[model samples]
Target: VKSGAGYLPVDPSYPADRVEFMLADAAPVAAISWSGRELVLPAGLPVVDIDAVDVSEFDGSVVSDADRVAPLRSSNVAYVIYTSGSTGRPKGVQVPHTTVAKLFANTESVYGFDESDVWTMFHSYAFDFSVWELWGPLLYGGTLVVVDYVTSRSPEQFLELLAAERVTVLNQTPSAFYQLAEADRLASESGRAAELSLRWVVFGGEALELRRLSDWYGRRGDFAPTLVNMYGITETTVHVSHRVLDAALVADASASVVGQAISGLQVFVLDTRLAPVPVGVAGEMYVSGVQLARGYLGQAGLTSTRFVANPFNAGEVLYRTGDVASWNSAGDLEYLGRADDQVKIRGFRIEIGEIESAVLADVSVAQTAV
Candidate 1:
């Protein structure tokens, strides 16, 4: 994605037919794949087998500025990420360079990111969470530790990797972090818990259960690896608001407060009529500012429905997040349940309707429900 090309990432686990559908929708210029992976590329799209070429064989020649492809502008499409569709087919979201660039523009002050940090690419490339993991480090001259699919699946192996690599910054879904915290508990009991160098633990992609970290914090304490919970959506880049969690806040039984908006973004809890709801009253969230995506790819109707013109700003637009939230007494936004049936499991957003549709596709199935 850092190159001047806009690419679509496909999960290797996807069925061939599903892959074909995505390829047909995006109509990318070319496809790149690992040499050994069995992939069915679109009929005419060129395939670049990464492992087939040897870089040492080439004379290290640099392209002249005149001959090089022009650098992409901030408005250019950076990537297209597909979201689970309420309809039968998934819809892709076209994210521009400026939207992504804004995610990290002034985040260093809050997160304290620097070249000294060692980050891990823990999530799948197909997931938007991986965008921050992959680029945040490289863009700032920090080392990015890549974990294989197998290691990522096993919490024990993942913890081992984190200790071995001395990863300083860690990002995880609350579900995955729960497993890792359990593994840490087991390791601690056996007197084998590896000493870790993690300085920041950023959680996102799902609603966080603060109590889930009680055991992990019991071992590591509240100082090292400052814990942060971020509330975000793919449509609004990676994150919108961040809450720095401590033991005192975690012990509180009230709703999870997802702290104030990040730099260059505005968040509002509005009623059905787009009017701001009173504090402590639940309402649909509408996010504004530069972080918003251009809109859903090839989904004009859905885009128009969700991305409405900003009433406060003449030329700007706001993204209607189906999530319901309200302002707490502390001025932080507290998460309520989804306004719709969209559910997040293991950090992947799943539309229950989509699951029902897939189940009904079976030949023998007369009817199905999720």
Candidate 2:
């Protein structure tokens, strides 16, 4: 029977027909529901019902009749995550299972995953960041504390969850972290703050301002969590480069750099010609290696353009991150701005060109530039 790392079904409240159709399209060998829903097998595929199955209940005796054979297929379709239909319609990004595993392994290598680390899964299940936040810890047998929507929306509850869960490794957007820091909630909960086991906190989905992160850490004491500023695009899974922020680096007046590429990945600041730009000169960043996704789902044209053959490596593909960045004297990477019109606002990456193309439909302005 076909299956994946886990048998997590989509939200039960969603249309069952749509969910079934989606599962059929994805062609999973088995299905599991969070609720105790009876399984009605699809026409040809064998199915396993994991309804109400807790982590402790792994006995195969329940589904003794189910086929236990492993299915063989290309690793190119582990996650078929649909993007928000902001431009026209939602399109799925088919990421390889191998890429997902590599990204998770890379994350663990960077943060040193351990049983002592308790991660709070913040992002929606649909978001790719959730892949790292959800599976990365579980991959290493670390504890995962799922954060509810209400707690994510409220600043007070956000801090309280960290303390209550004793979250060690947390990742969030700059805006959300800023909100939690700006609020005086942590001040009143001294006991809770003292209990915080936060070892590392990562910021991504937007350019993390060092001053803002420092200010937040300063509000607490030196014993507070170490902040990690990560940078990467979705096509590369989650993160490509990350820099750990310590009290000394935070106190430095100069802008902190994004640091070198993580192990197993190669990062290059290339010019329009795709040639490596000289040190200190700004150029578009390109990432190549196992962490890169196979391609965008059903958008071969778009995929072909962004995911191109690695200029240096004969058989490799590199994801062209249209971000203008440069290397500092210390060999750290520093982001300047977007090489294209795309901007990151409130954590969502918005392509200005796409917006402008849509606005051109309206006859309001004679000339426009996004």
Candidate 3:
């Protein structure tokens, strides 16, 4: 922010108790909300009513380095996004300016983003994916379209918005994109077609069913809106690896290939002993680099356990992502699934994702959950 203040975005739909809990946990200096929005506020907390402010009266000019009250540092905590705490409470991940900067450090080389691009704020700010979607346009000098809650839930409306705004960059979860693809298919078949200007459709949040994309390719092709699968977590600042999906990779129905690490990020698939496993062997994924978050807000114990000192990189810490994965022969990391998602039944290990994949393989099954 201009004043170097760290913000925590909570879902407006949260219940009174949940909202109050987050407010107490985060302990923000002030609470901001629109006038029309009725929020559950804590007593004695400062409130900033956005709708009441007359922005037209302000200078609206860019401030130079000399005009600032204080110099903004890269180490400053840019935001604190609360994630679903495994323990039942929400834990905040304090993302520093440097981490966010590193996320887009190689935008030109990795993504080729520029001023001409237009990105949509598709995911909620409570989710770490918003960090990428929100800062993407700002860091890359591109346009940002803020999608409302109603339209964001409707795939048909979202697709129409993409066409209307000429959005060049789109980000989505595999589940969300599936719905959009279906909407696109229906529109095309119904002769109510609206050609989109999207150049990239990035995927994250969950494992993608690459085989299901065959229908999408049949209609729009893969090269038009180059599909990319970026795998990552909140503590790692949105994304770790970037892989542009193509027909070749998508042929393998069960393969969830998340390619090489981003420029300033590092990843390793290791065994229980913290030693790197052999290629093609499943292991827990660990990540380290500038993109790593400061840690959970006021959660020292959690900070130490997950963000432990890296055995390989002395003096550095690696965030122990509970994700299970392995390196392919070609140097790409294939996401197996969550470590906990794998269950042992009758002395045999079973990955729920594998079962889900097999069920989804059936043409009659539109969607399946395992």
Candidate 4:
């Protein structure tokens, strides 16, 4: 948004039909693409190939003139991130500049991001997790090593990249980390372990079963490269709650413990009527505060249903997350998966995540889908 233009990151690997559908929904004025990629765009949609941009001939001093300025407002929409809808089509979420700034502004102390760190941009820009992975280093003047597709797919290769680049901050999904941990174990057992410089490994995009990391903890421990599980969604500006995973919590935590809301944001577990549920009671999750997205773009009806007026506040709004959660006795929130993600078995309802967690608890189980 440096040039006051928002970006809608389309998955480079999406099929032509899928790409066209996203283009129609976002209605971006122009598409920006890098070299060596085939893009399918709507009719007459302006496309700019960044590889062909010849800005080298331009005088840097003139374009970088100190007086030449157009400041961006905090309310200005920074990007449009599309999230999957129940109807199959994706709905674009309008995230403002302020919403993004609010995330780091409140959690900078907790994250301890700085200029000395080196991060790897591993996830696709289309995924909201990439927002955290991309901006964390740039905003702090830190170095960012872009992971190639080949390396991203292989845990052994990724581990090699981390050691070669001396990457300090890493973000990954638990599923991906499982293999990497296994690779680390193998390397250690073979007496060929690569020295890692990671200081933090942030997890998101799914519920993390801490018990699965027993072997990893036994090897690396929890003190270094502090492992944190951040519960997040695209509409809520990436993260809703932050929980540092420790040996004690890993052994005791039954469900995914998302911990508490970051400083500026407010997350409440409320009943169907929007009334706050008592401690340890499961209910739908609602988020309120500055980080909330503007709403689903061009989908007024859908926006109204998802983002409703806050019952506790006079004129504020809350984004109904459709997530099931409850507060623990320690006042920390525990994520119980999506509210609508239940399966009926012989007239009894069971959350799919609960079953998945049980299956994952098996030491021999590598992955599961139920």
Q: Best candidate, lDDT-wise?
A: 1
Q: For this target, which candidate reaches the highest TM-score against the unseen true structure?
A: 1
> In candidate 3, what residue range of length 10 has the lowest lDDT sum?
342-351
lDDT of 4: 0.84
Note each model's CA RMSD in angstroms: 1.9, 5.3, 7.8, 7.6
Ranking by TM-score: 1, 4, 3, 2
Q: For every model shown, what is its TM-score relative to the native structure?
A: 0.95, 0.79, 0.88, 0.88
lDDT of predicted model 2: 0.72
Q: Report the lDDT tens digits of candidate 4 across residue range 151-259.
A: 9999999999999999999998888888899999999999988899999999888778888877888888888678999987888899888988888888887898899
Q: 63, model 2: CA deviation in Å?
A: 10
Question: Can you write out model 1's per-residue Cα lDDT over 1-370, one digit (the tens) per residue?
Answer: 5456777989978878778888899889888887897777877888888888677975566544444478557888899999888776888999998888889994767986889999999998989999899889988899999999899999999999999999999999998999999999999999998899999999999888787777777888898889999999999998999989888888773776788899899999999999999989999999998889988888899999999999988999999999999998888988887998899988888888888888889999999777
**Which segments of candidate 2 are over 4 A away from where they belong?**
1-70, 73-76, 84-90, 184-194, 221-223, 253-256, 353-370
Task: Using TM-score as the measure, name the better of candidate 1 and candidate 4.
Answer: 1
- Residue by residue across 72-129, what tens digits does model 3's lDDT show? 8888899997765544466788988888888888445868899999999988787788
Clashing pairs in model 3, backbone N/Cα/C closer than 3 A: none
lDDT of each: 0.88, 0.72, 0.84, 0.84
Model 3, which residues run further than 4 Å from truth?
55-71, 341-370
Give model 2's TM-score versus the native structure.
0.79
Return the lDDT, model 2, position 62: 41
